[model samples]
Every structure is written in C-alpha cells, then in structure tokens.
Target: MRDALRRLSQGEAHPFDVSTGWDVVWEHARYPQKAVLGLAAGRLAERPLGPYDFKAGECRRILTRLGFAPVPKRSGGQESDDADDAAEADLRQRTGLGPTEKASLIRARRGQGIFRQNLERVEKRCRITGLRDRIHLRASHIKPWRSCSDHEKLDGNNGLLLSPHADHLLDRGFISFEDSGALLIADALDTRVLDQWRISQPRNASAFRAAQCKYLSYHREHIFLGRED
Candidate 1:
C-alpha cells in the first residue's frame, strides 16, 4: 500500500523486498499487533500533511473520500437478511423467474404492489370496520410473509384488506377469523376499543371463499391469541 502511494504521488514505483513483506506478514500473524501503522504512514507522508490527508489514517480516510466504504462486520440480523436474500435468489433461479418477477415477489412480502392489487380483487374493504377506502387500508397476510412459502406470500386468498389498527391487531395475534367469517377476539384485546373502532359486538365478516377459508384456518390456529373456554 505504501509503495503504491509512492508510485501514485512521485511517478516511480518503490522497490519492494519480498522477504521483508513476508517477515512483516508473519509478525502481524504471530505477535500482539498495535495500531501504529497509521502514525508511521503519516510520519512518512510523501507530501506535507493537509486537512484531508489520509496519510494520518493509513489511506482509510482517502478511500472513504473516493467513495470506497470499508466493509463493516455483519451482525446477526444482517446475516439473516443476507441468508434470506440468498434463499429468495435460489427460489427465483429454480422457478425460472426474471428480475421483474422476483421484484414483484419482494414487494408482495410487505403486502404492497402486486399483493395489494391481488387482495383488492377479492376484498374491497376492511373486514372489521367495513372501510372502503383503499388508501386507508392495509393488505395484510393471513399466514404472514415470514412464515409462508413464496407462492403463499402472493396468494390473494391468503390476505385481507384491513384498517391499520385491525392489521396491527391481526399481525400481533390479538385477533383472527373463522372459516364462517366470525371474528375471533383474543383475550388480550381490550373489548372497549372495538366500539371506538366502530366494530359491533358479536360480528361476523359473513363468509370466506374456500381458498380464503383455508388460509383463515392457519391464522386462527397460529396467530389467534388466547383461546376461549
């Protein structure tokens, strides 16, 4: 790195001793290393030190100034996201899906884009409050995006257009639905809030399609919190 800097600044390559380079590499590997490289580099700067001089930081600062960000150590959540991305890519490869189709699937994961459009086909409004305005409603997954297969993620029958509060409740296992479309209120939910949300007591969403009912069954089993007597 130092030799490269010299060549770039002075237009003459520094003679590199391979034996010395190997010796330094071995010393770094075996000995307790100290962070003196930057100070040493700064002292040996080819030109006078300036405000933006990366000679003080062993070129890391200059690299950043040139838009070359140093790679950070990945945390557990970052690693998980990377693994999920790899799995999604593998799925796309196996299914022969192009970038556009893969992108659609990714958007569907958040119940936006294709997923919202699909839900609009089957459900026109929020099931709980009967809110018809699309802009105010959320297309939420019955089996949830994280728990579902790729096909299930975009399944129209696996979703509902819910108000924000309703979606939050459903997602957090505070509410669910029966195949008969009867609302299943979790014990943890404060019943008083239902009135504020303009939801009636002993309400039923009427009935679900067979496909929707299939997904509802999964939601009731897994997401519906606090069983009845």
Candidate 2:
C-alpha cells in the first residue's frame, strides 16, 4: 500500500492489478483495520482524480499510519436537530431578533454578492489548500453570522475565503487560526481524523491584516475548542 501511494504521488502508473488498489491493501490488513481503510479507499474511488484528490489520498495514508478503528456514525436528522437548536439559542442570546427578522438579516448578510466581493479583496485563495478558483471557495465568517453585531455582519475583516472542507472545520470549531495565521486544531479532535482530512495544525495561513487579526482573536476566544491563554 505504501509503495502504491508513493508511486501515485510520483506520477507513476497504478501499482496494482486493479484500479481499486485500496481493496488489496484492505485484504492484507487485520479485522478492524480493514473496515477503516476500506471506507477511506471507497471514498477515494468515488471522487474523480484531480488536484483536489490529494486530500482523499492523504486520508488513506493517515488511516494506515494511525491504525485506529472507525468511529460510529450518528443519525443525520438528530445531528441536524441539535445544530438547529444550538443556532437558535445562539441567535437569541446574541441578536435577540425574532425568527423572521433573523432570517432576513441572515439572508442580507450571508456571504454572497457584496460580502463575497469584499472577501475577494482580502483573500485571493483558500488559506489552507491554496485553491484559487472562485467556484471552489466560500466566504466564511470568522465570527459566526448568528453571533455577530449588525456592523460586524458585513465587515470584510470578519470573513475568509476558505475551501468547503476548511470552512467546515472552521465553522464547527474543529480548527482555527492565530493572529499570526498559524493553524490550531482542537484537542478533542482525533489526530488520525485530522490527518485523514488533510488538516495540518501549526501551519501558517496567508497573511492577515490587522482588522482580520482582531476578528480572528474573537474566533480564538469564542469559537476555537480547547483554547488556552
């Protein structure tokens, strides 16, 4: 499996008889290990090969290295319900706006049109993956929208253009950045999961302006998990 991955990284031909080389790796592994690797490889096979494919490939390598068992999946509906409840509670505490007003405000301030254009002025690419394509990037809030003041909702400094995956990590507080742009991973997150997701900690991001740094400070204080002085 290692040899195959090495060859793939070097731009060499597929090292196995079948295209699903990960299946071969899984077959050679022990009980629980097989299930984890098999799942990772299966995801890789689902996506078309491209520069974006690097993350999925790296996931397989990380899974192999860590040798951790797969985590149990949670129900989508239950998770969504919990998230909705949290968002509602946060909105009530921060904004004190009614549901209709909140919905309107969210629509107006949500990252699109002017907000997106403003983000482009500050960030040319994803800070993590360095992906420059506009289509593949999102203008994610540094301080979450539901928790922001009216002024902050539209502030360019309070936003970042991140790849969808990076945005997911940031929004969920699985990762954050320092004022100096160094990546910070939550202690609660499994190292293997971080590796599989290609989330590198202690990595510097693209340069941040002073205003962005202030907003980032808020994120570190309020959003980042396991934050320390």
Candidate 3:
C-alpha cells in the first residue's frame, strides 16, 4: 500500500487526502484480525469479535506481511481486549490513522487524480462562515474521504471549504451545521473556544445553496459532538 502511495505521489495517481490513506488497508485486514486490529482500529465493542483467532506468533507473521510492526506479547498480546485498547490508542496517537482515516487512505490509493481535480473546483474558503485564510483553511469531506468513492471525492457537491480551527472540530465530530448553514457548537467545547471563534454569529449573507446543507447533515450526524439544548 505504501508503495502504491509513493507511486501516487509521482503524479501517476489521483489526489488523495493524507488522512484517508490508512482506512483502505484496515478494511482489508478487518477480517482475520478483527479482534486484534478491530480494537486497534477503534470499532465499537458492540460488534462481535470474528471467530478467527491467531496466536501471538502467528499474528506476528501476518503483521509482517502487512507492513506493520509485530504485536508484542505484553503489547496487547493478540486480541487481549484490554491491552488491545492501549496499543490501539498508541497507534492512533502516533499515526492519526484511526479506522476512519484508514478508510480514507484506501480511497486515496485508488483514485488519486480525481480527488485533486474536485478539490480544485471547491473554492478555498469556509463554506459555513466564509472565512478565507489560506493557512487556516482545509478542504473538508462532505461524505468524508474515507467512506467516499473516487467519484464522491471529486463531486463538488460533497465538500465544505473550512478554516483549520473549524476543520479540526468538524473532523473530530465536535461541530456541525444547521439546515440554514449556521454554525452549531458541540456541548463539549469550552464556551471560551466558542467565543474565541465567534461561532455564535450566523453565517453572513453569502446565500448558501442546499448542497451545502446536505453535506452539513452528514457532519451533524457523524461528527457533531455533544447534545443540543
């Protein structure tokens, strides 16, 4: 997969989001190592563990083939759920390539060109608040790059241009949008952060289209943190 990503960087591939590159591989390995990698990948525990089992020795071999470091016996010890969580958290912090990001990576590997093409069409401004600082902006996923297909990534209808602060919250399921393009804050956010960003103000008179609203719904459902009053 890394080889494919390198090839992609050489201009032979589509424009893929950096975060999405890991998702594709995780989905591939979800089956055999569901318990081990599943916890590592941060899937809900409600999901049943797959019947498949491999001892630490065997898991080490599989991890080698997949280009990952072998799981240490004490280091999660192959499907030990408690330790598995620890290892998973460590991997996530180091790589920022959680399950969601893994899915994004896979999509990126498949369609590098198309993703870039679409991002170009989306103007470099926050579609929500119309903040236009380039250094502070990000090309956000509407359907999310990981779950998105090549076509979806390229679809102008499936994205929002956002500033980095807003993008960080949006990416982490912290913020959402109203049907009318108003910024909605998560309850978890300190009131100070909200005031700092001026999230209380409604969007200016930019006349947002329904397409933006459509994507906002996904953000609200999947990414938005905290409950509404």
Candidate 4:
C-alpha cells in the first residue's frame, strides 16, 4: 500500500486501475474514516463527489485545499461531506489514521489539483485531433487519476488532451504512444475499420510534451495491443 501510494503521489507508474479501484477500496475499507480518506486521496473515483451529495462548504474545504473550488450542483440530495465527516470522525476516534492512510490522502489531494489545472491549461481540447467539443473531450490522465492518491492525480504532466474517442482508445490500450510522440496503433486495429474512423493520417509527433511522453511509455509497455500494420 505504501509503495502504491508513493507511486501515485509522484506521478510514477502504479498498478491500480481507476474504474474498479474506487468501488473495491470503498467496499474493502472497514472503517468509514479510511473510506473517506480513500475518496479524498483519489482512490474512489476520477471525478469529484457530487455537490448535492455533499455539503457545499465541506466540499469546498477539501477542494480548496487541493486548489479546486467546489461547484454548485444542479440536483438535490443529502450532503455527502457532512455525512462523511460524521462517519469519519467516529472511525478516526475508534482507529486513528495510520501512516499509510495519511500519506495516501496527501498524495491524492495534491494529484487531483494538478489534474484540474492541466485541464484548464489545455483548455480541455484534444491536442492531437484538435477537437474542442467539450462534451466529446476528456481530462485524461496518462497515469490514470484514480490509480494515484492525490498528488499524482493532479499532476499536469501525468495527463493528455484527447477527444472522447481518442481518450477511450488510449485508456483501453487500443492506442498508445512512443517516446517520440508517434501514435502506436494497436496490432488488433482493423485497417478497414480504422479508415472508417478517419484516424489514418500520421501525426507530427511533436504535439506530446516530455512529461506526457513518460506516461505514454507506461501505456506502450503495459497496455497497447500491437497486432497490425
């Protein structure tokens, strides 16, 4: 756990997968305090907790510390932060925070902030495709945000600007990158099908930043499916 947390905090490679990590951690943490700590550490979900589900003020405190001001929710529900605080305090009293827990929270919070700032820096557009449609773009973490505690999640160097489709491809390892910034088309990618998707033009290989390339190295080694031309 310490090793995982350390990697997450530094934006280094980690083994955790985001989509399932949160649910798994939430279910496994016996203590509410530990669970809340996990959530705050970016171990629960890639995005912020819901506003209606959490008091604006409390959420603001956490987000503010991480450099993200909580936004008002359009819907309604009991505030999660209030409930979380109550539950966490009880659990914390029952079992004080361990060293691992404290480190994880610190890392998670910092990482999340870095991610938000990167999104703003790129103006939330796919650097390669140049697609600027907000709904179709994603703040993609090169090293998935959820895998790290807090600091790793927010590190701008750990992310990439991509369209939803490109994000999906990259996220799933169907596509990846070389250190030189060349797109590593998956071997299993059907050329006929790819042509229909309109992604054939070879990119200039200069759009990716050095930090972004570091994360891509992980994807290339661990995820990219190299099957075809």
Please, what is the whole-model Cα lDDT of each candidate in the order they appear? Answer: 0.61, 0.59, 0.48, 0.49
Best by lDDT: 1
lDDT of 4 at 74: 16
Which residues of candidate 1, in runs, are more than 4 Å off? 1-97
Tell me the tens digit of each residue's lDDT in model 4 across 100-210.
665444343333334556555744566568786755666666665434434555566677767767776676656777777677775445567557667864664555666
lDDT of 1 by residue, 1-229 (tens): 3333333334332222111000112212211011122223445765433323322223334433544322221132343345557766666676667778788887886788888888899998888988998989988889867567878888898899999998877876677887888888865567888877777767788799998988887776544553333
Scored by TM-score, the top model is: 1
Q: Candidate 3 versus the native: TM-score?
A: 0.45
Q: Could you give candidate 2's per-residue lDDT for residues 161-210 as a string of tens digits?
A: 88888887777666788777778876545689768877666678756889
Q: Sort by TM-score, best first: what order?
A: 1, 2, 4, 3
- lDDT per residue for candidate 3 within 1-229, as digits (tens), equals 3443333334442222221101223323312222333333223455433323323234334455677532211111133334334543443465544676545444432323444346547555776556776556566665665444435555665766677777666666556667655566655567787688776644443444676566666656443543435
User: Against the true structure, what is each candidate's TM-score?
Assistant: 0.57, 0.54, 0.45, 0.47
Candidate 1 vs candidate 2, lDDT winner? 1
